[model samples]
Target: MVSKPSSAASARTVSVLALVAAVLVGAFLAPVVYDAAAPTPDRVAVISVDGTITSYTADQLEEDLHEARENESIKAVVLQVDSPGGSAAASEQMYLAVNRTAQEMPVVSSVEGTGASGAYYTMLPSESIYVTPSSVIGSVGVRGSAPIGGSSNEIRTGPDKASMTLDHREAQIETLKHAFVGSVMEHRGDELSLSREEVAYAKVYTGARATQNGYADDIGTLQTAIDRAASEAGLENYEVVEKEPSTRSGIILLSSQNGNSTVVVEESPIGYDGVRAPQFLMVYGQVQYEDEVIGNVSA
Candidate 1:
């Protein structure tokens, strides 16, 4: 009958509709499942140093450097150093970390804004040093200071108090400076040929001058530094992993783990000429407050 033929046609149409619905559902989900199962691409580790060099910064760089060395897929490391300078000990630690890491992988130092004093020392061990045209690069020297109090000559029972003599303080500063000079000479003795006077004076130099004076290897931008690293490592195309965060607003407060205990005051509050006063003392490796008020608090 005509009804039978119409019923057969309707049944075929229902079957086709069901197939189309199933196909649509699969098409939507296939990509989602595939994406979830996909592997992440390997990336090179980028270390950025901005501001003064410190033990914390060195520790962070060491950690990342070790990670990159262990992961074979990581092609190279780019060190973006922008700093004025810092403690001699901190600079030495960072220099050692970079040298050790460079043995396993290509380490490139890219001087962006400023790399001076202790900051410049860190770049000596790198495979190649790159600097921007306008970047400030060299300040190849060392400095150390200790607080001297003019007002109080109170006799103390502890070894901590006994150790606070003028002679001892001067000796400590000299020792730190000597160590810094030694490190510089160990890495760049032939190139720099730095004398005692040069290291002691702490001279600042521009990027071009640094390159000319054998303080820097080449003058180039950040991208050029990256390209140089990649070329050295024989990487045709590698991903750049910028590990440093864009915003560093909160980083300033958290830089040094050690409390700001050493207070250096410029002018003598005790009306003493050519006398320095330490506001606080470090007793047995701990910060101890000094009650005696002395010089003008410049720091």
Candidate 2:
């Protein structure tokens, strides 16, 4: 016959089993408890594009976008835009910069006040464009002062030194317009309800109209855009780090009722350096005028 085990041995065994179970439960819950106690969120970078998009502004914004791309901590980017657009070449530069950044990570654009012409062009590569009810967008076109006749006594190295013919200027304008419209179609074609020709009309639409016409995404605030960008980056917990550009006084170029345009060279945001030259502009609103005005195109 076998002897029965002692009651003390059974009690000790039960205690050991209970201790093992407690340790298992603690191991499972430690990470959850630590996460809840000190939450560390991902980061989203906010870059602002205010005022006219001149070479100076484009340079600043491009640098910011480059930084966001290189920073491993920045999971996403939100472009805070509020501008009427400016210099065509500068705008193209911005477009390229934004496109490059978007390729690496998620990029979203938020139009605050007016995002027309070149400003619109810069945001083409964004995954989504958020705007407020009063925000404006569109104006997909190009403009420039027509080439003017050189002085009769002025010596010229070539036949087109001072200015080109009207036909040549028109051709240049058409080319730029085609490029702008084509970019719009390429980026938002699937969502747009308007035709290429209609886009060429260069009409500025309100936020609601822009959404309906596919020029913009759903109506949302700047914060909403930031949240959307974080979501797109697959970040449930995130923090926004705004990258503010250097501040400088700006010269406001206003167009009078009589169709006259005036530009102040001093501290001008357009970066013209006080010289008005005939150059293609992807911009909306009033224009700066020069003596040899071939044409002042606008919407």
Model number with the top lDDT: 2
RMSD of each: 9.3, 10.1
lDDT of 1 by residue, 147-184 (tens): 34652666777756564666766676667667666766
Could you give candidate 2's per-residue lDDT for residues 150-212 as a string of tens digits? 557778898767546678878988988898899999999999999989999999999988999
For each candidate in turn, the TM-score is 0.65, 0.75
Candidate 2 clashing pairs, residues 3+ apart or interchain: 146-294, 146-295
Candidate with top TM-score is 2
Q: Would you list the clashing residue pairs of candidate 1?
A: 149-277, 267-296, 269-294, 269-295
**How many angstroms is residue 281 displaced in model 2 relative to the true structure, after the best TM-score fit?**
1.8
Candidate 2 lDDT at 78 equals 95
Per-residue lDDT for 191 in model 1? 70
Residue 226 in model 2: lDDT: 93
